[model samples]
Target: MRRLPPLNALKAFEAAARHQSFTAAAHELNVTQTAVSQLVKSLEERLGVALFERRGNQLSLSPRGMGYLPAVSDAFDRIAAATAILDETDARQITLGCGPTFAMRWLIPRLPDFQRAHPECEVRLSTTLAVRELQSQSPLPDGVDAAVRLYDPSKPEPGLMADPLFTADLFPVCAPGLAARLKTMADLARETLLEVRHAPGEWRDWLSAAGLGSMVPSSSLSFDFHAFALQAALDGAGVALARRPFVTDDLKAGRLIAPFALSLPKGGAWCLLYRPEAAGGSAFLKLRDWLIGAAMPPTA
Candidate 1:
């Protein structure tokens, strides 16, 4: 290692040289003026050079001190910048806002994998009603670094950038017992129809696709959220209109059954939404990439 002057001495020299006054340097460094003078004197003694010209009531750098200022100042600036970066990275917590159903049905189960992979970054989740989020004119609420929501690219939200994660395909699903009662798609007309009130047209569209446009269910139940509707269906309350992402696990585990093979594409996609500038942050990018990867189909 190269020999260097004491850090305190160097700091005193730099500060005193910059202001051309030990009194001013002492004020900035929170030290006594005598201490600043002693530190600078020690630095000068070590360097074997007179660093300052001592004229009464005036202080000025010598030729050698003038030459040293730029390098010392640059080194301190670089050190400050590097420390700031370290502090920022160490404080890497992302607050994500999403709908309750998406959080419950899709994200929460898979979050452990993300946590395992990036222990340095913490993810705090906040849930809201999808209907309110979709229809709100304001930006994401305070403390929400980003959001995941259904977005129609045809009608983009102002000042927001969206990265599509998954498209939801709608299908009918219910408890296996309720499903067994239904022999075919046309048989759905005899049972209660379950729906989320915000997207009331989904049932009609699904019916029309199944060639039962004129058919109406024996009765109906409407909930405020897809999660509630799906839960009701799980309890054998009725046949819920299931979205692909929300039902994937339940369908595979036999918790719910889709009797019909038909699945209709919804109008928009579930996407990650954020301000355009947030895309540049490393924390956001990591979360975004992980979400996209999680949404991908498994390989054979």
Candidate 2:
């Protein structure tokens, strides 16, 4: 039989030791700091060894703990990644990730077509809200195959492989009702513009490029998600200057309308992200091809 510490104790130790703070560890494990401390204590008692030395509200890994942590971490990460792969029996799972706006605006509308093309593939969509939530993404969870991501290509890699998918162009959009009320860029002062909090400086940069540098509207609607911003447009809340792919469905459906003929090409690009170490996955490849089909331009 395999000799092992209690699963909870091991998890507690990993989280606590990785962060060097029981509080930070508790946040990841979703347990009380005191509970995590107790679990670590229980583990040390069971093993008859001190894994960490407490030093005035902080922790330092003991000599033995320092030697043990790397191996234990690698083993757990491998077990988790493998279990995720083994859970898919029919090769039907693909864990997809994208910004809320991209998913709602670009991918979700086209998903049914994908289902028809490959009835064997089941895509599990995950809303990865740009870069802010990148770390929240775990190795494709048990059964999650792959993910699509939107990122700034100029930005450094965050470990995942980034593949060029498409260039997302930013433009001003509003409810059809609101669109009728606007006459010129100067009319923006009378309206509330929905801005993405995460993509700071984008609105200003676009406006400045248009030679309207001083046209900062006094009122605004801010949201962290593209989805929420789009929702605001649908509800006639305000105008949102968002990427084209993310608002394609709403624009096509006439729930929203483009007020400006000029579209600003953004610095960010859409990417197909996957673990470099993942073994060849036939199902994942097929899904990647299907997405590529939709992203490609007609002339290309």
Candidate of highest lDDT? 1
Instruction: Evaluate all candidate structures by whole-model CA lDDT and list the values in order.
Output: 0.86, 0.77
Pairs in steric clash, model 2: 95-145
Model 2, range 112-163, lDDT digits (tens) per residue? 9999988887787776435535455443333334555656657746555666
Question: For model 1, what is the alpha-carbon lDDT of residue 171?
Answer: 90
Q: What's the TM for model 1? A: 0.67
lDDT of 1 by residue, 83-161 (tens): 5434666347678888999999999999999989988888889885354576774446656778888787678877778
TM-score of each: 0.67, 0.63
The global Cα lDDT (0 to 1) of model 2 is 0.77
Pairs that collide in candidate 1 are: none
Off by over 4 Å in 2: 1-90, 128-145, 154-159, 277-279, 298-300
